[model samples]
Target: MDTDEQQAYRQLALSGATPMEIAQVAHLHGLGAIEIIRLLRSIFTLEFIEAKELATQAVYGMSLSDYQEKYLLPLFQEFEREGATAQDELLQSGDDRHL
Candidate 1:
């Protein structure tokens, strides 16, 4: 999305418009059908993720970053380390098709 499109989308979203409503408004704002769909999907996905994070923070009584640092960051780091190890093994074995 360009600057104008981004501003319009942000304005519409902040005004509490739903994805479909945003798409409609964006279409009327001269965005193409594909562009509207892509923009709406991107915005919806971001909003959904943010909402989930907020819910987690509310439930845990901690900031999202704090909660993630305490609970999720280690697991993610471990997964990354394991993934790297697995990739290294695959490369060493010359079986890197998956990689």
Candidate 2:
């Protein structure tokens, strides 16, 4: 990293800035925003992004998991409750009406 970037990131960490926050600043300041966020979060989380590519990925859309414990599973459970059988979920959505 350049001297300026190193200094800025150190300050960001010391200030207890979040990944999302640092990301916004980097964008406003025309710095590599996404990289900053990824680096910061990776320091504290399991996520990772190469330092050089971090900035671009931050501005780009995030790839979300189709499976989430909170929403996806719960919603599926509710669907099960609503007569969405495991067998049914195994099939296409519109197949139920035909069945």
lDDT for every model? 0.69, 0.56
- Per residue, candidate 2 scores C-alpha lDDT tens digits across 1-99 of 466775776588678976565665666666555456555554445355433234444454342242245457888889878765655775755555545
lDDT of candidate 1 over 1-99, digit per residue (tens) = 688768778788888987666665665676665566567656667465454444444345566688889989999999999999999999999996998
The parts of candidate 2 lying over 4 Å away from their true place are 32-46, 49-99
* Residue pairs in candidate 2 whose N, alpha carbon or C atoms collide under 3 angstroms: 34-54, 35-54, 35-55
Single out the weakest 10-residue window by summed lDDT for candidate 2: 59-68
Q: Residue 3 of candidate 2: its Cα lDDT? A: 69
The C-alpha stretches of model 1 lying farther than 4 A from their native spots are 1-54
Q: Model 1 lDDT vs. the true structure?
A: 0.69
Q: Give the best candidate by lDDT.
A: 1
